[model samples]
Target: MKGISYARYGGPEVLEYGELPDPKVGPDAVLVKVRAAAVNPVDWKCREGHLDGILDAVFPVVPGWDVSGVVVQPGVSVTEFTAGDEVIGYVREDFLSRGTFAEYVAAPVRTLARKPRNLSFEEAAGLPLVGLTAYQVLVKALQVKRGETVLVHAAAGGVGSVAVQLARHFGARVIGTASEGNHDFVRGLGCEPVEYGDGLAERVRGLAPEGVDAVFDTVGGEALKISADLLAPEGRLASIADGDVVGYGGRYYWVRPDAEDLLRLTELAEEGVVSVHLSQTFPLERAADAHRLNQEGRTRGKIVVTVEWEVEPAG
Candidate 1:
């Protein structure tokens, strides 16, 4: 099968499209014929060898995590799904496994859930990593409550878009930071849009006189430190980006995937409480171009790769 693989870490140019042997399915895994795969900042970070100490990658790694596909073969122990079931999931990052960039991938059954009935493969492909990250930060770590006011940085990006919607669904009023161009877009997601950069804290203060109940920082840097000051006393703060640790009074969190959290996000999508926004799609062979676009960091939402394949009818 043709897939994107990198034998060494460097720039996006290092990624190449080529042939690789099909993955062997395990007893608790399912072999999926990938329909679409989404790009995350983590993909590039991994590609550049940024996660060296924390995540050891196998040479010639396929770099993607979120995937939407149909199950072509189920493991002997898997009873929840059969061949031809449409599913979406976050492949484990630990092994640096061959991922969704390929025409096919083997995922642990527990990592996947039935794709939302209302979504297309491109849409479902954008949800797993970003959706789960947002869900976990708001519902699990911060425990955002109804009537609370929450602040989200980089509100127009993939995870930020989902975070804004989920916070509003939980009854919390949301304030999101994006450029002026996306103000209307963020507002449409039930958030008050603020311009990000210097004086961001002042802009937020103008909106919430009493201070925000929680802060979800997706653009970690000076923004993370500034977000801490925006927090109300006893407020919650979580960062999904790297180097976000700060001595904030609120809880500090880094997003990690749990099968349970993915299940919750799946339910939210199925119920129409959350929506996935896919901004762009590229063919599997253009993985390099996909990475370059994501590195630019200006996309409105998720970027995905479509793998050509035949979909069996749902039984």
Candidate 2:
């Protein structure tokens, strides 16, 4: 099957497109034919060895985690889905080898969910990781309540955008940090948008005077450093970007794949409670370019890489 892989950890130059062997399915897994895959910053981070201490990489690694595809076959022990079932998955494991960037992936049942019928494969491809991150952090880590004020950093971004919408769905008033240009875009997602950088805390304070009830930090470093100041007493804080958040009385979160949580996202999507915005799309072979654009750090939403299948001639 044709796909992308890298034999060594380096820059995007290391990614190559070619034929790789098909994956072997386990009893608790299903084989999904590639339709589309979403590119997350973590994809490039893993490619460059930034995640090496946590996830061991098998060289010539196929690198992608989020996929929207169809089941060609189910594993011997599986009954949750069968051939022709449309599904999406955060197809990650403890290490990197087989991944969703390929023509097919063997996804464990624990990572699979039925795709939202209201979403296209490209949009559905962008959901699993970002949706899971937002849902997990908002519902579990921060416990944001209705009528509370919440602030989200990088509000127009993949995880941030979803977080803003999900928080609004829970009846919280949201404030999101973006740029002057994205303020309109962020507002469209149902939040008051504040430009990030110098005076970020002041801008957030302007919106909520007493301080927000929760701060969702997607931009770390200096942003995480000041997040504590933006919070009201007993206000919650969580950061997916910085581990130092733990030092500031916040939870440093890493998103985990859960079928139940993903299903909730699917339901929200179907009900029009949340949406995945596709900022760009690239053919599978040009995945390296996708990484380059995402690394530029100005994307408003998710970037996706698509696998186009040839149409069979009718006889």
Candidate 3:
């Protein structure tokens, strides 16, 4: 099999595409033939060793988490899915080694879910990590309620875009922070768009003078601090970007893969309540380029890397 990997931590330059050994499936995992993999900021972060404090990297690590693919074989003990099932997964474990940026991956059942029937493989591939991040944060961390005012930072981003949409679905009046260029895009997601940077607080106050009922921060540091200040009395705040949020009386969330949660996201997707905007896509061999594009930090939606295989003609 072939995949993208980096033998040591560095920039995108460290990533190399080449032949790799086939993966062995575990008792609770299934071997999937990769269709598409989503490019995320974390992919590069892991490549550069930024997550070293937590996740240990096995040398020559394959770097991807979100994936949509078909099951080619199920483990001996697995019954939840069989060969030919289409699935999506956030395939991260405690360590960096096996990943979705390959021709195949052995995904644990806990991290797998049936792909949304309404989405293409490219779009479904972008959902797991970003979708779960927004879903878990809004539904569990902040508990966004209808009729409440919610503020989301980086609203046009992968996580923020889904966050704003989910908040609105829960009946919250959402205000999303994005660049001036993305205001219209943010507005289309059922959010009141506010330009970030320079008087961001004032702009938010202009929309909700008293303060918002919930703040979802996707950018860390100053953005997280501003979100902490924009909350209404007894308002909730959560940040996926900053661990320091704990110091400001907010929860710092790390997205976990749950089969149940991913299923709900698929339902929302099939029901037309949630969707991925595919900003760009690259072939698996060009995954390094995908990382470069995401590192630019201006992407409006998800970037995907696709694996294409030739099919033999029918007998």
Candidate 4:
């Protein structure tokens, strides 16, 4: 099957597109025919060996974690889904290889969820990793509650956009930081938009006056440190990108695949409580371009790679 891969850890220039061996399905996995895949910053980070200490790399690695596709074959032990089911997944494995960038992937049932009926394959493909990242940080790590005031860094970004919506859904008054160009876009997600960089703290203070109850940092580094300083006396903080949060009495979180969390996001999508804003779509062969675009750090929402395939009706 045709797919994109890199034999060694490096930049987007190292990616190669061609035929590769099909992934084998394990007894606990289902083989999916890829319809669409979404690019996350982690895809490039992994490609460049940034996660070398945390995730084992198998050379000629297929790089991607988000996918929306049709189930073509279910393993003997799989019962949650059958052939012909349309699903979305954050298909990360214990090791790096056999990823969603390919024409097919053997996804464990734990990572699979029924696609939201309201979303197309492209939109559904964009949800898993980003949606789950925001959901986990807001719902699990920070435990944001009703009527509280929350601040989200990089609010117009893939994760931050979803974070803004989720915080609003939880009844929190949300303040999101983005560039002036995306202020309206952030407001559309139900957040009070503030421009990021220098004096970010002062701007947030002007919006909240009393300090925010919780802070969710997606940009890390300076943003994370600034978020820590904007917190109220008992404020909580969590960051997906910065480990520095731990030193500042905040928690650092890494997104994990939870079928239940994915289901919650699916419900939000179906109910029109959350929406994906796609910045670009590329063919599978042009994955390098997708990576380049994401690395620029200017895209809002998601970048999807669509796969062309004939869908046969299940008899």
Residue 212, candidate 4: Cα error in Å is 0.4
Worst 10 residues of 4 by lDDT: 304-313
Deviation in Å, model 2, residue 5 alpha carbon? 0.3
| True lDDT of residue 168, candidate 4 | 95
lDDT of 1 by residue, 121-223 (tens): 9999999999988888888878999999999989999999999999999999999999999999898899899997888889999999778989898887898
lDDT of 3 at 103: 100
Name the lDDT value of residue 246 in candidate 1.
51
lDDT, each prediction: 0.87, 0.94, 0.95, 0.93
Give the alpha carbon lDDT tens digit for every residue of 8-46 in model 3: 999999999999889999999999999999999999999
In candidate 4, position 78 carries an lDDT of: 96
Clashes of each: 0, 0, 1, 0
- After TM-score superposition, what is the CA distance of residue 187 in candidate 3 from its true location, in Å? 0.9
Q: What TM-score number comes out for model 4?
A: 0.98
Q: What TM-score number comes out for model 1?
A: 0.95
* Tens-place lDDT digits, model 4, residues 1-315: 999999998889999999999988999999999999999999999999999999999888999999999999999999999999999999998788888998999999999999999999999999999999999999889999999999998899999999999999999999998999999999888999998778888999999888999999888888888888889999999988889899999999999999999998999999998899999999999999999999999999999998998756999
